[model samples]
Target: MRLSGGNGDERSAGAAQGRTEAPAAAIAVTDLVKAYGPVRAVDGISFSVPRGAIVGLLGGNGAGKTTTIAMIMGLTLPTTGTARVLGSDMARERHRALHRINFQSPYVEMPLRLTIRQNLTVFGQLYGVRPLRERIDELAASLDLTALLDRPSGKLSAGQKTRVALAKALINAPDVLLLDEPTASLDPDTADWVRTRLEVYRRERGAAILLASHNMPEVERLCDDVIMMRAGRIVDRGAPADLISRYGRDNMEDVFLDVARGRGQGAVT
Candidate 1:
């Protein structure tokens, strides 16, 4: 019982109302596809993130989550289809929207020789943040990096570096945030603290967030909607509770297992 398409009339009607009557989606992807030689990294898939909403992108390795996110960020070009952020086509006009968006990934590292302050300052300057010193100070205080500001980025522990990466991402106060494995290396207590801070940041700023993560509990706690991908296509999507109930599962972990292992196909809707 795979999901079907939506109504055309409703979509047309919504389009007719225009931007003023209905705000534009913060992130919009339509039939997005990406390929490498004979392999299709991301098959045709479409979805959107409304303003202030947090959407989770879930998939096992080789399921296309990273490629999809890269296309959305304009770091990788799609073989076909389109990704638009803030009404700007990512392939042709990402620069227009780049200043309003930010991304954080623990897999992406900062310069090792630069101090935490230096790294923040460099990113802030790139984003054209006004009063850059004050902004850096504010983030250091908020993320508890004040004491580590002068330390070389390479010298910090994994948890400390994760915090600094988050600070760098928020330096511009971006309206669209893309995060990949934001809490990958932190201990349980530190991970919880980081999750709490993210909630506060989203609530206070009304930012649209697209999160790619492997942590089922974290997704269940933070996401308003979840999109599950397998073999480069979206197989199922729904709210966390709705998906759990639909699959007759006790928790999202079970639901994820069903999706990942191709189990319970008759119940997947």
Candidate 2:
């Protein structure tokens, strides 16, 4: 079921040698800004993710969550400010910095014609994975993709597709994982499974993950810290439970709703 094509692994492995961990901060941002004409997409944002931690980026639509992620990934150049990944400045050393990081989002897609295994092979090669077959097999088993290995990516159900997408992201054994709605459209059981796997991956690799999600429970479960945003600005940042206790709310959802509506104060601390 493997798609025969490309020599990405050599490049990936070479890149890995050059890849360094982000020091104490897996990701660092300071006074970040991005603009689309008059609209300020990200307004003076700053945050840091520690190694081996799961941090959640939470906000309603247009709150600058995606914009911030894009800047971190070096996909969209910032209008101003600094971003660093794996301790390298994202703006100045993106090529060198990008190799250590990988991302997954439901909105992104693998080639529709490619089988699950084929897609994994392609990405594994891209990551310069040594022993690519073993890497793919490991990921497939961890992601529960063994049964769907031969299925065309385009033909799979939402849950199955998510699993495949996750496999693609982890194929390289990246140091920093960026996930945007990793469990979107998944049933509860599937979502829970994905969360457990992510937890294990973080612990095993000491990799940092920055997750952007709308599922409050998902964020609460998977993230050790939560950053809440509104109108492209971070309104609050704290542990999920801390925020809940601070606001006297039952859970993370209530805190999210209050921030989105601007009915509550920003930053509990």
Candidate 3:
């Protein structure tokens, strides 16, 4: 099954020129703030993912990465500011953009009693995916979910459920993909395989991906750019290699620690 919609490839091929002309955004956040009482989970954070880009949302626990993603999904209302998906304001009208955006997280569960195929069918229909059954079959094969398709979602092993969740997320061929711990719980080999598949999918569709994960190597490999959050605010932003050098670290994990530990404070770009 084809993932790339027509014209997306052309735009990606001329990405620089496209930016000069009229840059397309897959996700855009401007001074977005989400406060729970006096505590700000996401405080005045701003960033944008250009179409066809893969950006990492890097942070430690309680660093506000998840909260920001929730705001983008319109699952949590922000205290102030705006988040737009494909030019649609998710705050004001999430419905207009929900069909073209999808989220996958290991922590999120589908209906426990539903079979993998059943869950995919429901989401495909919700997204108004055409030839839905065929789409499901294609995704099952691509994600190696064929054998587990008929099994109840809750009965599957963590690794198996992860694949099913990925399949469900891609059922609609979303233009923007938000992934949280996408390869969590998989064995090393399986985790690598999953990363390769995500890489291919992003390239083929020229889609934008917002990856939230603790795997430093994974972030280094998959992200074109990274945003590091600390204490509910953006502390650093740059390409992974640039950040590594800027922080005088050998890898992203060390850099992540530096920012999370206050060493990288006021390093925002």
For residues 8-91, could you state the per-residue lDDT of candidate 3 as single tens digits?
A: 111221343433444666887877888888998988877778788889998999989899999999988889888889988888
**Between 2 and 3, whose TM-score is larger?**
3
lDDT of 1 by residue, 17-114 (tens): 34334456788888888989989888888777777878899999999999999999999999998889999999999999999999998668999999
Question: Which window of ten consecutive residues has the lowest lDDT sum in model 3?
Answer: 1-10
- CA shift of 87, model 2, Å: 1.4
Error of 3 at 137 (Å): 0.9
lDDT of each: 0.84, 0.81, 0.83
Candidate with best lDDT: 1
What is the lDDT, from 0 to 100, of the residue 123 in candidate 3? 89
lDDT of 2 at 160: 87
Off by over 4 Å in 2: 1-23
RMSD (Cα, Å) for all candidates, in order, is 3.7, 9.5, 5.9
What TM-score would each prediction reach against the true structure? Answer: 0.91, 0.89, 0.91
Output the lDDT of residue 56, model 2.
91
* Residue 154 in candidate 1, Cα distance off native in Å: 0.7
Cα displacement (angstroms), candidate 1, residue 247, comes to: 0.8
